[model samples]
Target: MDSYELAIRNTVEVVTEDELKELLKKPEKSVYTGYEPSGEIHLGHLVTINKLMDLREAGFKVKVLLADLHAFLNQKGDMEKVRELAEYNRRCFEAVGLKGKNVEFVLGTDVELNPEYQLNVLKLAQQITLNRATRSMDEVGRNMDAPHVSQMVYPIMQMVDIHTLGVDLALGGIDQRKIHMLAREYLPSIGAKTPVCMHTPILNGLNGKKMSSSEGNYISVADTEDNIRKKMKKAFCPPEIEENPVLQVLKYHVFPRLDSITLRRPEKFGGDREIISYGECETSYAKGEIHPADLKSACTEGLIEVLAPARDYLGL
Candidate 1:
């Protein structure tokens, strides 16, 4: 694929593909995404990380903002706790192949604490109404019924993050679309450059539901081979192609990393098969040529292979 195609691959949408094309022509350009420092890094986070890697491959400098302060402000935890989570999240990101010459990791506190950064944030706060800010965090804010003051400030900080990082593009999952749109709309009001935005689809879990820690339906890099097999055995893989979580893993997580996936089964079960493309896999499954059991097994094997490097790197 070409640079534009690679940049936009597996993405749900780009705010303005034309603007992204124009920005790509510049010799020097950068892109970034912010993370809220969760306790565990799973496939949910990998979607954006994979896109960031693509942007890096396309020669755009990539910045990962470990938003420790934002995590704290959003009431994830106290300052120290969120900061520690940030460090672990950084290590996990590197283990998953984000480390390289073109990638730079920035802490939210490092630049966010700067007087100038704070001043810009305050100015933005004045212009952004509570209704707009609250709307922007609909997909991200912790508690919405009666939100804390800090939750209201989170989106503005995000807008400032784009300006402070000086990235030409901002990348994230579709959940962040509202926030990115807010940045595009309001950043110029604060005399900051608006960022072209890219977003990837939010993959559902093995149960065809939201990937949440409480559900334990998602796979993590730290999972052992045996653990993966166990989870795969119980994964919800319906016959249909549209909402099949196993196929989603194949399409979004597996195919993008590996060239192809080979499903090994006995001749009695149609013998072994090599799927060269996600389209072929989906088509085969949809046609009933591929059984759901076989589909989940292949996804399990592919996931283990893809996450192996991280397992070794972390010595887990």
Candidate 2:
């Protein structure tokens, strides 16, 4: 694929195609995505990490914000704890192939504590209403029923992050669409450049349920190969194509890394076959030409192969 297609493929939306195209024409530009520091970096994180890698290949400088302050302000933990998690998060991103010169890892407090950054944040906070801020955090804020004042400040800081980072594109999962749109609407009022936003689809866990750490349904880079295989065996693999967690894994994770997937099966069960593309695999599976057992087997092995670098990098 060409640069433009590579940058936008698998993305649910780009705020403006023209704007992104224009940025692509530039010799140099930057893109960034922020994540609250998590103790474990799972496949849910990899989806966007993959996109950042693609952006790097597409010739954009990639900035990954380990949103430590946002994590603490959103009540993830104490500042000290979140700051430590940020370091681990940076290592995780590097292990997953975001290493090298084009990618930058930025800590929230490093810039956030600066008087200028704090002033910009407070300036944006003045116009953003409490209702707007609360609504923007619908998918991300913890403890919404009786949210603390910090929760309301989270989205506003997020808007300011795009400005402070000075990125040409802001990439995130669709969950952040509201917050990005908030920036588009309000940033220019503060004399900050409105950011172009790219959003990726959210993938479900192996159980075809929401990916939650508590449930342990998602695969983390720290998972051993044997553990991954076991989880894939128990994964929800309904025959139908849509929302099949195994199929989603193949589409979002495996195929992107591998040119094609080899489905291994006994000769009695149609033997081994190489599926050349995600579309072809899905079409065959939807027609009942392939069995769920075989599909799961392929996915189990494919994910193992695709995630091997990260596994090895982390020495797990």
Candidate 3:
């Protein structure tokens, strides 16, 4: 499929398809996606990472920034633990088949203080007024009342990532849309081409809320097979409810072919069934056409099978 179709199917929120197509045509242009190393890497992180790899395969030079400084700025914790988390997160990425010379992994603190970097940040900050930066904080989980000077300057530094790196596109979760907007608004004033922004859908937790580590509802990238299986088994998958979050998780991460194999429940699996996609599974359950227990078992088995390699690589 072409870039436009890919963006549509992937739920990438963007300003215009023409701009994305233009950037995709320029194979030499680079792109960036970053995450603050505040805690264990979760499935949500994987969605964005996989998207970055997809872009890399599409011929864009991709950079994955480990936001160590941003972590310090946002999450309060022991410095040693935060540092450990950063290294561990890096290994997790490598374990999940995301590495090599093409993908650049750099720490946020390492580059945030460079004179040239600071200069670019200041210039970008000047382009965007304080009022605009305040509005963008909602995307990053900061409230207007909680704005630190660093928080206000955060988007500027992010914009500098696009400027200094000469990136033509920025990939982020839907949450980072505002920050990328700031980049689009500010980068041009600094003489750099405004980077096109692309975002993937946010994955929901098993409990039908945002997957959050603090809420104790998240499945980490390093979860063990038994843990993963247990979590899936105990998750809330009601047959009459169509918007089952557990099913959503499966649809998002597990391979589509695996979903077909599990859903169909071919005679090999003790039943002759035909489950095509996640939507079908949900519809069947909601209509009282299929057993919830059976669907949960199929989803658990499918998720375990798909994540087994990643679990092993993480030594979980």
Q: How much lDDT does each candidate structure score?
A: 0.91, 0.91, 0.72
lDDT pick, better of 1 and 2: 2
Q: Rank the candidates by lDDT, best first.
A: 2, 1, 3
lDDT by residue (tens digit), candidate 1, 236-286: 998877877888888888999999898888999889999999999988888
Clashing pairs in model 2, backbone N/Cα/C closer than 3 A: none
Query: TM-scores for all candidates?
Result: 0.98, 0.98, 0.87
| Predictions: Cα RMSD each | 0.9, 0.9, 3.0
Q: For each predicted model, how many residue pairs clash, with residues at least 3 apart or on different chains?
A: 0, 0, 0
Question: Candidate 2 on 264-299: residue-level lDDT in tens?
Answer: 988998999999899999999999989998999988
Lowest summed lDDT over 10 consecutive residues: which window, candidate 3? Answer: 255-264
Task: Give the number of the best model, judged by lDDT.
Answer: 2
lDDT of 1 at 230: 97
Q: Which sections of candidate 2 miss by over 4 Å?
A: none
Runs in model 3 with CA error above 4 Å? Answer: 1-4, 78-81, 142-144, 238-243, 256-259, 264-288
Residue 138, candidate 3: alpha-carbon lDDT: 74
